[model samples]
Target: MQVKTFSGASSQEVLAQIKAELGADAVILSNRTYRKNGELCHEIMAGVERPAQQGGAGMPVSAGAAPAPSSGAGWSEWHKDWMRVKEQLFMLMKPAIRMERLTPRQRVALEYLQREGVSDGVSIALYNMLAARPGASVLESLAGIVPIRSWGAAAWPQRVHLFAGPYGNGKTTAALRCALRLRKEKPEMQIAFINTDCLRGNGRLTLRHWAELSDFGYLEAADAESMRKALALTAEADAVFIDTPGMTPERNLAQWQHEMGIDEQPHATHLVMCPFYDGVQMQALLHRYAADGDTSLVWTKLDEAVCYGALVNVAHEARLPISAISYGPELKQSLSPATEPMIWRLIFKRQLPIQSGE
Candidate 1:
């Protein structure tokens, strides 16, 4: 890995420099703000993995020799090692967690969270936050890790939106719910639905039915050329929602988008997921659906989940804000723009985000 330090007047400026020099794959090792020469400055240490034989385009010299492993494989191995090390470190630090400083209620809450399947890292962070401030509640400490950026025009100003996730995760439903919510809020806004899941009969029919009934424009795109024409047709609309197909284990969302020419547009991709998956499955799904640029998490099937600990774990791991959440079997009135109160209530009380008389 090649590491370098960048300093600038602002963190955004320093980050831009890092991305420009190290490419988008660069990871920030550390960042700090300090005063230099009577002026406030931001400094960050960023590192990027060195490419293997840059000019060779990852190809082996000899035709008979085996091809080198890809960078993704290398990173996967590194991530596994890092997770093992983190678990070991957390075990070592477990004894040092000063639980005595917390109130009885706070301690009970933390213990409950542990039983609910929250990760060790999040527990330690909550412990530190509560111990550092005597008056801080467990919910407040959790809010620091689980950020909420509600879904709407205000939160997501991008004209193009894409929904992606694993099979049976409710990607199509979430996209439709979001569009309906946006339409309810602004009746004059022009909305369009572009269905890319041509292989799925149910999803395609659902999207087409809702689009036509609601008087919203709809199009289907199964390839790069079709996707281009679909986008061009919806260019005049105020908001364009693209419903993507569920990804298989062998496929990657970022690479697929790049191949389909969807990456060329300014858009936000919401990763719609259910909270019932185990830790390993959730992590695998996150890795498979990972993409560049604007992205957020949209947790679905909240009504079916027993324990919501995976939500906190995913939020902590991905560091992406929660945009919306969907529950119940019905699409209408089942989704809600994620809020801190709603999430905390669901996590701590097992309460659904259902409105009165719903």
Candidate 2:
């Protein structure tokens, strides 16, 4: 007997074809239903009495592959196991289904983010969550995902405030601005400046100039011993602001930190950056600097940045809150407390807040 296979959308359709080809003497060797690329198909294998040569199974019994015979009682056991696997595959693929439901605007927004150097995983995750929310606009969906902490969320902790970041990231400027803001918020508060960035050509002189003008106490520490001496002066002030050299390597930065006696001192460390936000290295920067919620993110020199996606991407990846933002060179007007709307304006619109006149 030769074995032949038939397939159709339903069993009756396939059975009719089987009867016409093999007559009533045909025996159904196997039958099963399954989904192929999300479409359901039914297949049947039948045996007919005929003198057949070996390997004649290559003949097109029907469209697609000819079904082979089952080992024992047919495909009952095989089908059961297959169905279980199919269900599990369907479950795991549900997220892909959700991805297919993204709106055109959301897709456009995703593309925009990716083009602006946002990581693929972060972009996909944000869009998937947005797609799941019905009636949610892209701007509205994005407004919820980007993390920002208002500058004023927590009052200036009466502790040593330290700023750390790579060179030219505006660490000194940020530390000075933070101190000035704190002083402005509380007029009677006494603030002192400690500069650990002894290597930079003009960092100490620049900070000292400002310190002399403001008449706030100032100390320059070149090594661990100097750092200790500078920190001791913090005892006489309401709050001490610590600024480290941006030129130092990561290991040296850690060494300076260790020598500075932060473990023994009540201190708040802020990771400063000039919005160099993009890619795996950017994420690594966040990981290396912004260790936890306690370590605030300080973004400096927004006036020089044309794209803010890096900041949003870093914030999303690190799950770190932006504590402050510096907009320009002027100390009085440049620094502002970070806020959701401010970050949203920069992110979605790619536009900073309009100055009063322009």
Candidate 3:
């Protein structure tokens, strides 16, 4: 038995990271929630034990396996009680193990069940309610509850590429990288980079560097008319990428749409994702971003993460075709179009390798 440890803000995050490193068939041994470094964290300890070739019991015995000293007559009854509890937990978690589709929150609930020795009936009742409601968190559903999935370029439409996400998700940097990539790929093609993030100094500096290096057109839009006029001019160019500030769920998305003039010829919306995020939170975050139609996913910092479970959930639920994925901070050349087989290898194990152009 090989044991591994992981820590994350949520169980979904931890599991996603683990799956990315260990693969889907890895067995979980134990999981628990604990406070760490001033934040609530989930600590999961898992084991990756190979299964037996033939159909046989594969449970690993404890190293110091020995009968415990107990009341002489009561040992048998105690053992039966423990076995019953274990059976209940196994039953409760079996559904999740077999489920082909599970939300991040649902995934967390299943983990909790596996850890807490919950009954099968309890797990079912909770899961069913969540299935019916469809909006509650996974934890909420399991407590009887619980809650809670980018970008592509091809023949740009002289239209601006809008980058919007929560703060620190790396929007401005990506915009610059994309610009450089476009310049390298088609030097003759006219390209422009627009920045709407006037409030951030980093945004301005990044755009400035792009302007100097690529000799590509750069525009700034402080007002709707300016943005509209800029769009009108850029519409003549081969492609225009618009970089917008990271907005929150609290702001009126409609107002932002109106201000950014997104209502007119909507540009490709790319949802930038950090690999460090847990599965459940990632789904919730994607949902918020996807509220606006025509949104695709751009997975960022793959070089920094081990698990890709969030990627799996995003692919499954949103049914959003992943256009490109980025591994690092290099210019747009660091990003590549995500293919089905690449995604498969990232998720399920035992994937039969298929030849490209097949």
Candidate 4:
């Protein structure tokens, strides 16, 4: 495994630098802000591959290095501490272990168990899994446990494209990519790009950019009145690609539902997701987006990821049909619809290659 250190003025800048050079597969080892000279600067250490083991297994164990025998009182105290931890885990898991909804942490622990081939003692296994994957939370880990359903047929051509997800998850770019692809296939499809992202940046740009290049009709809406107008305009058009605002729907599904005017009819709604995020975070993001009932998924940043576990997990959990995949910033050619075989290859058929630092 190769470990690399990068220094920059800020954490975000340093993260971008490392990702650009080492790609997104690099695991972050540690990040800290340090005083360099007189200025506060960021320092990040990342690595590829797992850490080396402490010693070879061939060496015999040394009994002389073992800890001295503990007194009776000390032994009792240690045993009590172990029992307390055990009880806490049980209490924490008691409600949801069988509850239909799985939290991200529990989901990750389950995935860890699957990966490690551990068959029993879920509580202990979960603890050990958390220990190995620090910063991984129950909510984030469980997002992968989304259920599956048979999306027997797609209702695409008849409907406009609806894009939604957490902030900065790339909803706009994905929508534009879809618009571009549609333009190639049906030049006179009467498509309109609707910008529901009233906030700064994000989906607004993707819609605005595509509208500029292709002369596609553009609409902006914030409240129910505007959205109603946009929907009416879309009624006459062949397709309406709606770019929604990026919001984290953790505690308030109302905000998303209200903002999107959830009552309005949409041809298709796709949850745009980035591959670079951690497993637990990804799950939490998915859960929040999947709140709109049967929304589909569109995975972005494929060229930037290594592990395909999250992709598999999201598909299984949300039971959302995968609409499309956007590889890069390219227009028409960069987009492709999601397929079952494509997913199978990512997990079972392909051996991810190691990328050397550029």
The model with the greatest lDDT is 1
The parts of candidate 4 lying over 4 Å away from their true place are 1-155, 249-255, 349-358
Q: Against the correct fold, how does model 4 do in TM-score?
A: 0.54
- Regions more than 4 Å wrong, model 1: 1-70, 74-82, 355-358
Q: Please, what is the whole-model Cα lDDT of each candidate in the order they appear?
A: 0.81, 0.65, 0.57, 0.57
**How many steric clashes between backbone atoms does each model show?**
0, 0, 21, 14
Considering every candidate listed, which one attains the maximal TM-score?
1
Q: How much is the lDDT of residue 17 in candidate 2?
A: 78
| Candidate 1 C-alpha lDDT tens digits along 1-358 | 8889999987657756765786544556776779988999988887766767554332222111122234344545645434543443455358668788899999999999999999887888788889989978788788888988999899899999999998788888889899999999899999999998999898789889988998899999999999999999999999999988877656679878998899999999999988888765676677778878889999998888889998898998777899998998887999889889888888988888784332
TM-score against truth, every candidate? 0.77, 0.66, 0.54, 0.54
Which candidate do you rate higher for TM-score, 1 or 4? 1
Candidate 4, 65-96: lDDT as tens digits: 11211222343333333333334323433433
Could you tell me which 10 consecutive residues in candidate 2 have the lowest summed lDDT?
A: 62-71
Quote the lDDT for 94 in model 4. Answer: 46
Q: Lowest-scoring 10 consecutive residues by lDDT in candidate 1?
A: 58-67
lDDT of 4 at 193: 79
lDDT of 3 by residue, 50-151 (tens): 536423233333211112312234434434433443443344345454433456766665555534333343445455566666556653443212111123
Where does candidate 3 have its weakest 10-residue lDDT segment? 62-71
Error of 1 at 20 (Å): 28
